[model samples]
Target: MHLKLLYCTVLSLIYGLALGSPAISDSSALADLLESSDKFNDHSVVQAFVEELKAISHSSRNISKCDQCVARLAVGKSLALLRPDLVPPVFTQWCTETQYMSNSTCLSTFSRNTVKSSYTGTNFADMLTLMDPFGYDGQLYCCYKESACSKPKTPDVSLSHKWPAKQTKHKVAPVPSANDTFNVLHLSDFHIELDYTIGAEANCSASMCCTPHSKNTFANLTSHSHKDWNSYYDSHYEGNSLVKGSLIDVFKNDSIWSPATTFGHYECDAPEILINSSLDSIANFSSTNNIDFEFAIFTGDAVDHDELSLTSYEVTVNSEEAVFRDIKNKLGDVPVYSVLGNHDTFPYGELGQENHGFSNYFAWNAELMADLWEDYGWLGSDESQYARKHYTGFSVETSMGLKVISLNSNVWYKKNHYAYWNASQPDTFGQLDFLIDELVESESKDQRVWIIAHIPFSADALPLPAKLFAEVIERFSPYTIANIFFGHTHLDQFEILYSGPGGDAKTIENVVASSWISQAVTPWVENNPSWRYYSVDKKTFSIMNAYNYYTKLNETFTNNGSAPVWEFEYSSREGYNVTWPESAPLNATYWHKVASMVNESVEYNQVYENYAKRFSPYVPDCASTDDCALDYCYLTSFTVDQYDSCVENVKNNK
Candidate 1:
């Protein structure tokens, strides 16, 4: 019989660690040893394989780890090899696995150097299986703060997370009519990787912006990050680098890029330190700023992008739960509505809908949001009752009677693989109809409504037909709709839909269906990681002004002995200077001016640069003038017809 049959575990563990998965090979010495046994094939084949292994063995120490392991496979080991006492399976597995595994530590007698060390002995798979993807779970691997990278951190005492000090007074200026104002925190896309230091290069270009999806090409690390340190310097700081917070800046402040990542499969997500720090940072900011958030809307894509490991249902459930649970811990009593991003669902962009009696997996996923989010004041808790087909669009009315509708816009995502299925569903699975009903209810009661969804409305691949969606929006824009908030584009953008029905009808007399697409908090692409807090009119429910904030990736806590700057970056009404008639801020008239400037060849640059604010200066990389103009037009357009019109305007301008 072949030796491999006798020693499968030893060989499998070594192969999995040294090479990459524990998959069997056809050309390996083990394969030859297994196939060329006297009972299986030519005995000469076994002899040749042993000679080849011996050739490699003599170049190393006498029956070293590799030799001993290989020797066991080729020549066969004594029956003692099977004894767990002589060589425990855990030790054997860990030594090889930890050495080769990307995120691991060698079990130090007194030191905790496993997370970053290339040494072996730790069981990373065991650690990973215990991880809570969102926040601190004892199961995740973390180092002690006092002796970081040297000692492992014991689990935090699981208890009720301490909440922020209660809000006593309002700070910002309220609207003209109302005596009060509501603060809404819009946070999106935090691609938190647990261990990024494993393979992080000195000048990986994705440092400031996004991590390229091609980082998983296996052979070579093909990242969108800057090629060298000099290019990175030139791109971020020019020559005048902000010499503070250096260590904690970039994609991962406290850690390095994970070497163990593959699609859907990951060795880790945000470590407890980093994840808790982020939440603490936000809490501290809000406290120091005297900000009292009435509510918050976290536009989806909570899970990190470019998952190398294939996600399973169990994984999806764990990750999704961890995210919401951690948010609850951090925010405390602050009610925040959430929607599933394309990445939030299993299988990346495929949003599966229910068929016949078959439960749609996406619906199941959305139901998880419903079940977990009920404590956060999600009114659509009764899953079977509130859903419009698989689309989860339900309204939660506040004590003051302000209605907020969370729309499952993934049905309209252009990148969604199941768009065809969404389009074919009856009445768009009552998505649009349900929205109209909500709007109608709000209109009758004069209760203004706000929409929070993942994907924004576009003509192509949307939940409802663009025209129908526009008609419903236009019908309601006059009576009750307040603002529509969305993400997924990963950049700061606005959609200005006509408040009235048709062409050039009344530019000044129009109502702006104000929508804001918040920038992603994840420093994945070149987009500056950010979130926005909008000052909303409590009575009118109109957005008065917007304060956008961003984190500087290059600035770390270690830099210049100061904390990284997470300052208020800009304000919409203040920076744009589109004031008309004194009080109507960012209205249709203002949007029209912006759109005109966008189409205006001479004025487009300033306006475009104004909005496309990155951590550093942004240099446009458009191939030609037409390409630039088309993008400008696309951004200017708010509705489906406007998108088409925006395209026409660009072509005609050409």
Candidate 2:
């Protein structure tokens, strides 16, 4: 959810990407002094660093994107290596002085240990050691990894394999008058922060707040400014300030902006009690309603979003283990199929593609996830082993003869730096091949397939892979694939994919497929904690309706740790007040109709926006702005190209 914010901050600060912004006067002066020949024993290296900084600043717009990137990478690497001991603290001081990032966030993300660890054992680290400004590795890292330039264009991959001949007209299954349906539980982005503190600063200045280490406010950040470097350095970095003391300690006496509630807060991830409450609610609701779910799909993101300084290998593993265990305990005997989210890993978003040479660096995650799945009886021994080798992706055929293909969609995630290395290829991890194979087999068996993954193939995914995925959907959607499900945006949303790759839908016949982007369980940002379940027609195995449920997060503040009242939010078919034949499945065509309604009717659009974030107070006025039109554009488009074109069309009309 904080993907763009984190990426931009890192690229702008750590990579020295200027982005046409004028350099901060104090930071530039400090850089000049730090790179002076008098301080460094290696004057040549210092001179090289100075020149690179000059090139980055003065010629930022004129230089080739790769050159600009290379210069920034070179300068930053040289500065770090020149005085490994002094660089992190100096950078921390500069970061706080300019208010580029919170002092806690900067120290945690760019500490001496973090910096040193980043430069050790990895291929990227080796590339940095080479110190070749003009090297291909440097250019690749800058151009693709940092995305300093437009990604290289590649030809559209013809449908991975030719699909079966279309039956003159597409055939959709009809819903019977008394549709025999079963429920499907979908929970995503639990994001349980183990160190969550009740009554802590929910309005803290960190990227993620409400944790034990989160600062109370930004008013005290000046205490670590560049002017106080000597004194601050002596007291702060000397003993346990970097490791032992909490960053929250400095602002302990400050009044909290918004005291974190018992259940959760808008600015932070879900606390343990909140996670338990959510699970308890789901269990109680299902039992009370007698809605026996066929199987639950936990679509990734078990770990918390404490990425600034709180994330580590131990935190990730422990958090995931605790969350998964809670799921198993609360929802007994209901097998849960889960996948790894971008935040589920140690470095947050560094999952490596198969055969990418650095794949082993990420093997531990797959292995760990596989072990848990097997122990929890979610997957068979063979299936878990297969997932272990397949980047924690597995396909399991349910007792009902439906093929459930769980994918590790992080291969297409924008935050995973490993994905950008050779991104021009259509399928970086052979996942497309695996998907096609599964779909082909399911089609032959006359079995409907449900594809579940973490990240949606929207703007969050890279263009090439998302395009390939759309093409796959266009090929096999109505015939074999029943639905595609994802969760990452933390909003209750869905997108309709049309017939062509660019998703040009001029007629209802162009509707090919749809993906359900489930709302997150974590109230990260302003979203209320929510979960959803769909009524799937047993005969067609397609979703007939989706029911959303959520609790008022603010209500928990007055309840004194009492369980929040979980209320029925809305249902896809009846809630929106949209018209459709009751006998028809809620497919792409139905969603396309919803988009059309949203585009033309202001009243309906406001209702849609209210339901999106479960009535979060911060929900924007889509009807008053261009967002309703843009939402229409997003819903009607699948591939990135189509999304871009739709956005352009909306802007042009505006």
Candidate 3:
């Protein structure tokens, strides 16, 4: 009896399936209603068919054709409800299919409707109909439309059917040799001022005012009073003064005025011009030497502290932009990178309050930000907002094998007014993490990386733990980073050497460029205002320090009217294919060469000559002269006269 009941249920489900029309009142009578409704081709029959299908779908869970019947009925009912104007040809066929008494006839009518409706130019619809028989399958439909159903045409004989399979061999281009040298004109501590007049007012100190030796020198001295004293002193008096005199009186001495005065001021906008001229010289030199630069990286203190106001920030940005624009114009399309210095942030005002207006200036300038982003893709939009004054981890692929990572060290230090000292900040920790991650990833890729930052990891900046620097080097040892470049300490010549945690100590050479704005007035008599140029050899993956390669000041304005000169000095590696000398301690010998070169250059020659005459009268006439015979005689007579005069003066005084 159970088997008989099961068979009856199956028969009832199959026979009870309704046609395309409105739902019936009783599901058990749906099949009968559909059959009866097919006799009429009027709107009422279509509605009745839809109703019968709906009733079967709702009541008969076991009905196999319930969904199909409902869909067909819904379409028929929709057609019946449509206005005459809205009725399409497909709707007419749907009505006929629902009204027909024969099931096979109704199915044939539906197929005909589909064929007539499938009006695509390509045979895609027909192919889809052959492949899917149900509804559209996305992948099959796409294949049919895009590829399978297209009419066959004569294929190109040269084009292979297994195009990707027949791999076209690509030649691996040669990695740039480390020995392939390029000249990098390294400049730092520019302290460029905008609105020099404003500085002239602020810095102009009546009690501090002293007599300037020359008109130009006096003007610069006066400008110093209005400008930030520290910047003025550092650039002009402290850095550039060649004469051995009191720091206060250095400005008063007319004889020292020529080289002692900082020529780049905001009032006349001389800094922009000087920067441009230096760049021009660098480009010309590079062109002559057949050297191509990887990039030009400015090592912080790019701008002078003019004021902390919004207007001052705007002026500073404009001045900085002008300098960059000139550099870009001269250098063509070479990549240029910059790191923040203490002054780049803001001037410390009365109390501990820092005027944060400069940070906003950096944020709004799209060109400045874009330049940094293009070099270092790691700068996210979010980070750009909070610490706009600092930028870290700018990575660029200079060649197939060479990568550069530029970091901003300013974020690692504390800004106390115009003074910057190494102080730990949360941002510094974040930066360290980011740097480590980048180095590890670069090592994994087996690419050569170079790290560039403004401040060196030296003990003088003691608040910055040395252990951190050591960890950084240790983490990236596997990557075979070529070299790191930095600038900040205004050492005429100094080097900070380091040893990685495990490996032999690598002498990461630090180049301290002489201030372009002003040479320190004390110590060295020679006015050596210069910058370092580096040459990278792509083939060897080595960097050569080409120091003092560009003229900072015009010949006519500096020394005794001689053309501005560059000092070139280099140190050969102790052994080939090694990053550093095995046994040699990281020493200042390399930096000494740079300083010596600047001292020997034409710019320093005049200052040296003047110094020798004033301090060492006994020194022979070593000055370049036409007649060698006359030069020696002049030196001997001058020496003899000085000795006799000294002895007689001593006797008379006694």
Candidate 4:
């Protein structure tokens, strides 16, 4: 077991003090005080400080939320100014020791450079300007990250007030004929780890493994007993630095607990070899099947989940460039539309909205993506410019009159601490508003729209944006909006947004729009690498069929450097073994029926679970569990409120 340090709790106490009380603003005085005397280390001084913090934490001071956040920012900025090197290490230590976040996650999230250069802004003070005192980020940092304060109440941004009123009678598109269909490839979450080493550790103590030096390979640390190791780490350093060896060190690859192979591992992202092979397979599948794909939509995440300590802006940019180039090279003449994933950013999941005044800091990513997409001929100059201005989110109408709207959904992601500020606002970046504008235009033109993004508008996102998105779907779906696509979950799943009162799958008429979430090319954690392509009705722009293809990861272990073979895993229309009209596209109504089958049929439930993870061995047995029941609810519920209501209703009925 890795040594779990308790000193992080003390740091949390300090953080609580900063949040609750007016923090010391005189940086020069504070720096001099810390440098001249070790007040933070002195027992008498530290105990007094902790007591003061406790009093502040307990006190009901009539301070505004903005003032509180400003004070907290002051403390953090002062500390960073005093010892820039120490600040990041302390934060990383708190994340790892206090939150039990994996070392890679901690490092990636709070690295020294990432701390000073990215996130809300180029510096902490700029971040303070955007924060609301009652912001969700502070609550997350203080209540969850520090465990020093109670979780704050989430501001209610209900859809009842925001949802647009239906104008005319809801007009549903006619069931399409298969004879007028075309193919569109949908690839997502290709977390291509460029530095993947075949024989590296597949099983490690960290959240992500299967890379060179994936674990702390120090013999002194690894060989010691758990008790002795904890004692050693505790006594030697005060959550400051390792005593002898660095966190990463060269080790015998063969000595790993589980050796990685040519394809990939369940615990790791895709290697370059695996990524190339998958792309090759797609080309071959297209050729052999006599299928001509009109275009491809890549829903982001080109970078790997490497340690933030091991990553740099240059590394992130280079990895993405390489991956995009590879895609262009392998899939010749295929115009691939793309979006930026949460992991695609340097610090990971830290993109800020334009109104937040931090977009310029994160604009390099959008700019680069725009350039790449334009260079590949997937986007025109004006479209690329629009994408660059909007953080790589843009709407482009296809030559065939189908409007494709790609969104930088990370603005609403929970992990982008940037989003936590002014949490009550739904369209902070005006991206959702942009979406509505595009949808309205598409509706007027009688052109169907498809929304593509990296993250789903699900519970993993901040509730307000999700609700707003759900409202958008409710108003425009089944008429203007054909479908939405996402890929961050890395699971083969779907989300149905319904309109009207009771948000449930009790009737098909309520089903408005459905998001088709494709499985990932990166296995990451306990999943077979997979991809999907949709057979669409040219006229309706609705999906006629959905095909999933996957490669067995474990088989590559014995192939001895031979490439893994990609094969068809399932089809939405035929694979479920559920009967539906042949003329109908696999729309929201069809999915609603499948959701019912998942609830009532045992075999179908098991099969659904299996296909979700591409038959990974670690697929959970949700067939007889509340998990299976939740799947029904998850498919039916769109926004946070609906999900909560559905879950409560299910439990109450039971």
Candidate 5:
């Protein structure tokens, strides 16, 4: 799961980008310094890594087996992260010019390599170590995003596997709303591992950085100020003073390592206590918030990161059952629409149409809903119409004439291992095509639409082409698609989508759709585990007010003596200071007010930047505002290209 988290978004700077390696005035000079005198050279290092990449590429020229597909992507991405600057010119040119590259799968479109067929299932230690960006950490290679490497990944397989119905959703009075007003409880990323411990100080840290000390995608984030740099270390790093050791040494000495040894990635994955507390609180909030939420949308990844140990199909079924049953019991009869996350499977993160590589990669959780949710009537008894894409999608019509379509966007996941592809050959399923049809049908009947998924169509989830995703979202136009809700990145952020190309070509007013990149309940990384309450336009369905709720970690774990304090954080309409439209608590008219600040007001932009993380978010304020403006603009219409470009342009300017 830590490895998967590697590709997750950066809410402050740019979200969902495989940020290119930092530029260098003289890469050669730095190479020389690193090789001989500086603090970078090493013994186990492969200086001719680029040559090795070529050899690997040449070897896989005629790869016949499907399992190698995993090895190809795994190894290729490892090489890229190991030395992105060392990316061969020929390879980069081919990737950028000849083929269509997904946000994070540049390695796949370009690399033609195959590892031995031994790295499957639970026996992946050596293979992962081979993929390790050699000589990482102070020798502490905690993780390398989506970390498929050597580390103390929690393999907690011994926990109560049954979901309890100790409490059930109580029937309550619905708060009155305008005839057209639509309210939704937006939830994402429960990451509920049956075995994850609560309040455990994880001294072992994990991150997406190329190096243990560096937190950015690139090892050298020279553009960031020292203060911003420190912030990176503060939020991402997990350890004591730098020490020379293997990734395993930390755990070897772990029984009493440090104050907060991050067991794997960040200190997260919900313990049952937390999950129960969270659900109960959210259920309570909907009843008392004085807002009428029509239904709830959980945008995937309800399962957690214990994939290696989750090798059995029974366990996978159990995990899904636990989460689903819990949500049902807590929400009572509220029809909750859920999506499939990458982690919601057996071998973890597999979403191919056929068996590309994994053994038990059948993603039929949604289909199972026919039985699990029949009483709720969302999926009803017949699953054929709803379970087209591995039971990962379905269109539920609300009484308000709004169509909420949950997509199994996992087919686009970076590590879906080419399930849609033909045995390491290029291929694609008609998932998106299916979505277009759904939307078109909705439009024909004059129905407002909302999309919910675990991953956005961005590199963060290793999604399909950015422009293609933009085209999909933009295809709906002015207001057919009211809003999108997603939750893989676990950051309190917003994505703004412009109907046209995402650049200076579009003016601030030329907007099409906006999304709430909802927060996670796991609190695995930066911010406190949180959820959202959205008040949407009765007519257009755009969010009028978004109230964020968080369990302050420090307070919950320690503050007034470890009694988890679940409290309301702030409202989007209130915190960002968007102008209050007299018609609603917040409205598109006022959303435009917030968007205008991104274009014209620095003060407002700063306020927006500070709250991006919801708890302790930061901006490279001391360094530059170009990226900041771009980040603010992203909330307008989130596009991967614009995000990468904004980051690159900002660094180039620096």
Candidate 6:
């Protein structure tokens, strides 16, 4: 019995060895074939055999048909993996049983009708889920109901080329019949400094002016000048340097510094060199063009700091005198009138007292047509104490019928002292009283009034003052204030505010002049640093103008020469026309051409929204204002995609 059992065990062992060795050897061969087939045609029958063998090798117990089935499965997987581009479409057409499988069995399960369905209707989403594990590009194939696939329709991507038509008929107001013609040069924010300082020399060419030196040179010169001047005059004479070293130092040594002597302190002093260059340029332009200006108006910021302190007042007055002298020398007898800026008031000092010493300085510097108490009694019994002796008005005849009303906005700084002092003053209510008085007077005489001030009556970016100013203008509607000219925000924009007796208030046109000191370190300079030139008709009191300004430093220097200058042509008519405020018609064609030219050349970004909100009603008429406000509002409400679309539209239109 033992011998027989031994014989059976030996036979069983031999049988197992023979079978197991072959299976193991086959599995090895299958792995090698599958890996090798990955590089060749995956549709090979041999590749399928290899994959099936791999599956069978891993089974716990061998079945008679396991090897065959494994080989077939491997072949299918190899074909699917290597020829996905071909296999995907075929599988989608034929597969049905296990929707996720790409094998022939699954393919055979689908009905021919189902396989012939449109690609869009095919279970592409499910196929993607199954293929994701294998990292397939699911977009490789799409099934269609027809035997042949059709091309997808192409999308239209061309931009619309039609130009926009003018939305409303913009009627040019009538030209008032006037007899006298006056030539006026409108300038503002003359922050003049003596000698080229505060990057002034940098603005000039080395061949024409001084070479660009290190900041240390500026520092050394400033220190030497301060010590030298202090010893010679008063220690306060430290402000005598033509170019101050650093702003921090200047602020620290404020007492010893004045606006005139210190160069690097503020933007005001830049006008010294700028004005000289500008005057030279203007002279050339005037000679070339044969235009003579009658008078010049400096809107404001005549000095950097308005203070009751003696040194501050002295520096400011001296600076103004120097500017006036320069103007007189350059233009030859053109009287220059200046209105005070917010900075022209005592710095955080007394608001009402006329004898605040700062007021006296202004009075002393002004030509003084009449005493404030004697001429204007609007200030009440304490007029002498609080009224600005320098706050005066004069009428200039642009031609026969056109007149300009230049008023001081600083007067209202008393009630809203915070606006001017805190740098947050809205341009409105502060000057309503003065504006009303001027409007009434101009309307009564039937004179076209060109209201001039330092700060704009309305700015889309800075709207508090604009809204306030708009309300005042609305109160005197249909009176036809020819135009309101201002210069505070530095950028050039036009807003037209037209309010008829019974119609909706229309703030359609408000024109802002650019600053002269274009490249100063100050925020205004960094943003808007161009100047504006105006051309007015003497006979009709009609004004047509353009801003030929740019921000290219080299270009500005090249055109301006060693010193840059600006020029304008002026003429006047014989009589004054007070009855027709809107009568003075502007040249719409010319205006549009100039506007188009400017818009094409310059790029303006939105910087003020909350300010614009104050004057929302008047914004629609303003291209920049409305667009900027809309951009801000859209960004707040929509997704980035929607916001981008709105922005693109504005840019294309502009």
- The reply for model 2, stretches above 4 Å from the true place, is 1-67, 70-155, 162-178, 217-254, 625-629
Candidate 5 accuracy as TM-score: 0.62
- How do the residues 1-654 of candidate 2 rate in per-residue lDDT, one tens digit apiece? 134223323433534444453442234443545546366565444344444355454654666756666655555544544344444444455445545457775565345242123333332332343334444345445544556655444445666544565453335533434678888899999998888875567768677788777766755443322111110101111111121222223233345546665567889998877777778888888879888888999888988877546678888889989999989888889989998888887677666666745556777888989999999999999889889999889899888878889898778876565564545556768888888888878776767889999888765777778888888887776867888898888888888887743667645778788899989889998988999998988876889999999998877655434466789999999987778988788888888788778878888788878888899877888756765667777777776677877878877876
Worst 10 residues of 4 by lDDT: 226-235
**Model number with the top lDDT:** 2
Residues 1-654 of candidate 5: C-alpha lDDT, one tens digit per residue? 234223211110120011122212123433343344325543222333333223332342454222222333333343343343333333444344434354234443233222224322221221232332223210112222234343222121211121121112111111224645566787788776564421222433332211122122333333322111100111111121122222122222223222221221234466544566677777666668665567888887866655242234555677778887778777777778788787776445655453223322353554565556565655654443556334456677777777887777666564544432221111244566566777767665656788887776544533124455566665564445667778787777766666454543445456555667788887676567678877776666666677888766544322222234568788886786654654553423355567667657677666665555555433336235555645543554355556655566656865
Could you arrange the candidates by TM-score from highest to lowest? 4, 2, 5, 1, 3, 6
In candidate 5, what residue range of length 10 has the lowest lDDT sum? 228-237
Model 2 TM-score? 0.79
Decide which is better by lDDT, 3 or 6.
3
TM-scores of the candidates are 0.60, 0.79, 0.44, 0.80, 0.62, 0.43
lDDT of 4 by residue, 335-395 (tens): 8899998888866677766764567677888889999999999999999999999989898
Model 5, which residues run further than 4 Å from truth? 1-182, 198-201, 205-266, 288-292, 306-315, 354-360, 363-366, 383-385, 388-391, 419-427, 461-464, 559-562, 584-606, 616-630, 633-637
Q: lDDT (0-100) at residue 95 of candidate 2? A: 46
lDDT of each: 0.49, 0.70, 0.37, 0.69, 0.50, 0.35
Cand. 4 Cα-lDDT: 0.69
Shift in Å, residue 379, candidate 2 = 0.4
Clashes of each: 37, 0, 52, 3, 21, 66
For candidate 2, which ten residues in a row score worst on lDDT? 227-236
Give one digit per residue, the lDDT tens place, for model 3 in 1-654.
233233323333443543222243233343343344446454654454444434443554454442443333333322222221112223333435445334433332232211122232111112222222122222222222223222222111221121122112111112343344555556665554443321122112221111121134244442223212211232321221222222233334332322223333112223433454456556666778777766666665555443232224455466556555655667666666555655453221100112322233223433365454443532345444333433433555564466666665644332221111112221223456556666656655656666676655431222222335434553343224445566554333233232332212222232211111111111111233345555555453444433443233323232332223443422223211224443322223343343343234543333333222222222233346421222111111111222233345545765
Which TM-score value belongs to model 1? 0.60
In the order shown, what is each candidate's alpha-carbon RMSD? 18.2, 10.5, 31.3, 10.3, 16.8, 29.1
